[model samples]
Target: MTLPLRILMPLLFWALGLAHAVAAEPSGKVLRVLAWPGYADPEVLQGFSQRTGARVELTVVGSDEAMRQRLLSGRGRDFDVFALNTAELQQYIDQGIARPIELQRVPNTRRQRPRFRELSAIPGLIRRVDGLTQVYGVPYTYSEMGLIYDRRQLSAPPDSLQVLWDPRWRGKVLAYAGGTHNFSLAALALGWQQPFELGERQWAPAVDKLVALRRNVLGFYSLPEESVQLFMRHKVALMYANYGLQQLHLLKAAGVDVGYVIPREGALAWLDCWAISSSTGDPELAHAWINFMLEEPASSLLVSRQGLANTVSDSVASAPQVPLRWLEPVESEERREHYWARIHSGDSPSRVLQR
Candidate 1:
C-alpha cells in the first residue's frame, strides 16, 4: 500500500537528511531500470546518476521470456523503464503495461538517425487507445540473428538455414531455445515466406521441423553466455546465432575461430527499444534515462563493447550486406510457446501433434 504524500514526504526527507553527510545528496528520486545484459553498463548508470542526481537501480534479464515474466509478474510496477524488441512491444501496448512516451521529454531522440526519428513509420511503435494514437517505444539498438559457424569444422560457411538440420552435423549444432523464435526459424527453414503467420496447414510441418532441430542439435541454449560455453565445450560446428554480433564478439574475445553469416533465406533481425512502464511514479526520470542512453558515450559503447548497432551512430563493425527479415508480431505467440515446450522436452513428433 502506498502512503499518503503528506506522510511519505516527511519520511523521505528525514531519511535523506540522515545520509547526506556520508553520501552525495540525491534529488530523492530513484529510477528503476530493467534491461538486457550489456544494455546498462556500470559507467553509463553512474553517469546518469551523477548528471541527474537520481539514484539508479538496475536489473539485467537474459532472455525474452524472462523479461516478459518479470514485467507481467509485477504488473509493470517492478521497474520504471525496460527494453524490449519492436516485435514484442504490441502486447504491452494492448495490455496497457506500457504507457505512451512523451517525446518532448526525451530530447535526445531528435539526435537519432532519420529512420528512427519518425516513430510511426515503423510498425508496432504506436496504437490508437481510446481514440488517441500515442507512441510507446523508442528505438535504441538492433542486430540480426545470423548463423555462427566454426571455421575449423566447415571448409566454407553454410549458406542456408537448412544446414542446422544436416544429418552430418547432428549433435554438433547449438540452437536458441526460445519458443516463438524457434517456430519462426523452423518456418523459414521449411521455405515458408510468412514465418510469423503460420496457417493451420503450416503448423504440423513447423512442429516437425522443430522436432528435427531438437534431435540434431548438441543442445539448446537461452543466453549468449550459455551458448558460448556450450559451443566451446562441445566443439560445436554450427550455431544459430540468436544474439547475433554480440555472441560473435564474445567468441572472438575467447579466441574462437568462427565466421558469422546470414543464411540464404534471410536472417531475422530485431530493433530493441526503451519503453516507460505504466506503473512508474516518476515519468520524468524514466524519460531522462531514455534520453541519457542516446548520448555519444553510451551509444558508442554499445558498438565498441557490446557489438550492437546503436540508433544514433553507424557501427564500426562489419555487418553483412544481405536482405534481413525484421521481426514482426506473430500470429499466435501462445500457441507457439505451447508446442515449443513439448518439442524441446524430447516429445516424439506423433505425440507432439496429438493436440
Candidate 2:
C-alpha cells in the first residue's frame, strides 16, 4: 500500500477522484476505529480506504480510562474496533464487551514478533473467560512510564522515582493527572510489586504519595501534548512521564532538551492492542483494520513518529533489557477513582483514606 512517491502521487489523485465519485453513491460500510492519536494516521486510513473501498472513522483517546468509559457507556457496540491495553482488554472480555477474533481472519498476527505470536503463553494477553480461554487483542503499540528531566536543570539523570518527591523540585515537577496511573506509580514508588492488588494497608501509603505529588507539582497534565506545553511554559525540572518515549519525542521535536530514564525500581508500562467490539456490524472489516495496522507503514510510523514500540519492527529505540511491569485490572477501579478525586482536590491522606 506504501507505493513510491512517483507511483503513489498519481494513485492519490485517482483515489481522490474515485472518492469524490463514491461520495455521490456509497458502496462499502464504515469501520469505526477507537485508538490513540498516532495509531490512525491520515495516510494509513486513506490507504486502507483506497485498498478496500471502505470508510474508516477514527476516534482518538487521551487515556486508557477514557477509552474504557466510552466503550462501557455504549455497551461495546458503538464502535467496530478499539485500541486498549492488555489490562483493559481483560476487563472488557470479562464483561462480555469484546468478541473473540478468529485467527484465520487476522493473518497479520503471524507477522508479529516471536513473543507476541505466542499469545497463549503471554500473561494477561490471553485469559480464560466463561470457562474457555480465548485470545482478546492484537498487540499493536506499547511504552513504559519513565522519568524525564531537563538537561540544564539536572547535571545527571535521576536514578529513582524518589526524585519526583524531592522538595528542591517543589512547584517545578510534573506528574500525570490521572488517578489510576498515579496510584500504580505511587505503589511502585513504595516498592509494592503488586501495584494492582493493593490492600487497605497499601492504600494509606499510596494516598500519601499522591498527596505529596500534588503538593509538589505546579500543575498536573492529562495528555502528552499538554505535558509538552506545560513543560515549555513553566520551569519544569522533573517529570513523571506517563507517555514515556512518546512524550520525549514530542518535547525534543519542540526543541526542549530533556532526558528520559527508567528508575532503579524500574518502570510501569502498557501494551496496547486492537480488540473487536461485540457489536461490530462487520467483523471482517474490523479485522481488516487491525491487520492493516500491522503493515510496514503503519507499524513504522508508530516508532519513527510517536516513539512507541510496534510489534513488527525493531527500528525504534526500545529498552529491551529494562524491567517493565505491565498494567493489569486492579481490585477496584471505582474505589481508586473516588479516592484519587479527593487527593487531587487537596484532601489530606488521612481524611481521604478514612473511608
Candidate 3:
C-alpha cells in the first residue's frame, strides 16, 4: 500500500476504537499515547503496564505537523499523552489540545536539570499568552543539528561550516531540503552572525549562500532514516543530521565509516517534551507513563541506547562527543521569531537551486 494509505488505515481503526471506548462503559484504564518513533518501545510500555496495570497503546507520528493535525482533529481525545517538539508545543497549548501538567502528580519532575525546567517553565515556549506561569509540558530528550561525515572519505572532518561550499566536495554533500535550520546552517557557514536570529537584511545573504551550497549538494533528504541510509550506502559523503549518536550507531552497525561533528559555529538545539492531552479521562495513567520515562533506568536507556539526551538526571551521563553547553535554553523569542521569519521567507527549494 502507499504510505498515505498505510497511515490513514490505522488511524481510521484507532478512531473507531476511540468512539466505542468513550461511549461504552468507561474502564478507567488503558493509556493511549501519540509518540515519535522509538519513543514507545514495547519493553517500555510493558514495564509501565506491569507496574500500574494501565495497558499502554501508542501511535507513532512522523512529524510535528502530523502530530498537530491529529490533535486538532479531536483524535487527541483518544490518547492520554502526546509528544511534541518544544518549537510546536505552544500551538497545542493555545489550541487547548494540551493542558498544564500537574507537577504534584509527577514526582520525577524534580529530577530534571534546572535549565530544562527553566526552559519548560518559560510561558511563551509552550503558550503564546504573556505572563502565564502554567507548565504544560515536561522536557524529555534534547538534540542538536550537526554534520555527519564519512571519516574514511575525508581524512579529517570539516572543521568549519564553509566546507559545504567547497567545489571539490560538490555533489557529494547532503542537506535537509526544506527547513529553516538548514538555511540557518548555510548562513552561519557564510559568516552571518547568529544565523538563527537573522534580520530581514540578513535573509538575502543567507539565501545567496544557500543557493551556492545547493549547487554542490548531491541530494536533499527530508527524513532522518533516509539520510542515515544514504550515509551507509555511501550515496552521500556528508550530511546535515540530528541525533549524532543515534546516526553514528546505525552507521557503525551497518559497517559504514562515519563520524559526526558540530561545526566551529554552534548548531541549533531542540528539545522534545511530553504533554498530557486535556481530553484524556485517565490522568493518573498519563502521569505514570511520564514518571516511568523519567526514572533512571528508562532515562539511561533513552540516552545510551537511543542517543538522545534526557533532561532528567539519571544513570546516563553526558555522551563524550556532545557538549553540555549546547543543551542550553534557546535564545529569546524575539530573536527566534526574527530569525525564523527571515529564513522561512527564503526557504524555496527551487529558488535555492536557481541561485
> What lDDT is reached at residue 163 by model 2?
93
- On lDDT, the leading prediction is 1
Which candidate has the highest TM-score of all? 2
lDDT by residue for model 2 (237-336), tens: 9988887887888888889989888898888887888899989999998988888889978998877766778888652445556667877778888888
Better of 2 and 3 by lDDT: 2
Q: Model 3: per-residue lDDT, tens digit, 1-355? A: 0011111122334423232111112344788888765565556766776777665667776555666677888846867898776667766776777887777888887888776767544334444357865677887776666677888789897766677778888888887655455555655676665554556566566666766666777767655567677666655778776444555555666777777777776665566778999988988778788888888566776665666667776323233343332322233444433443443455554443342
**What's the TM for model 1?**
0.79
Instruction: Determine which window of 10 residues in candidate 2 has minimal summed lDDT.
Output: 1-10
lDDT by residue (tens digit), candidate 1, 125-223: 888879987889999988778899999999998999999999999999999888988988998888888888999988888898999999999999877
* Local distance difference test values of all predictions, in order: 0.81, 0.78, 0.63
lDDT of 1: 0.81
How much is 286 displaced in model 1, in angstroms? 2.7
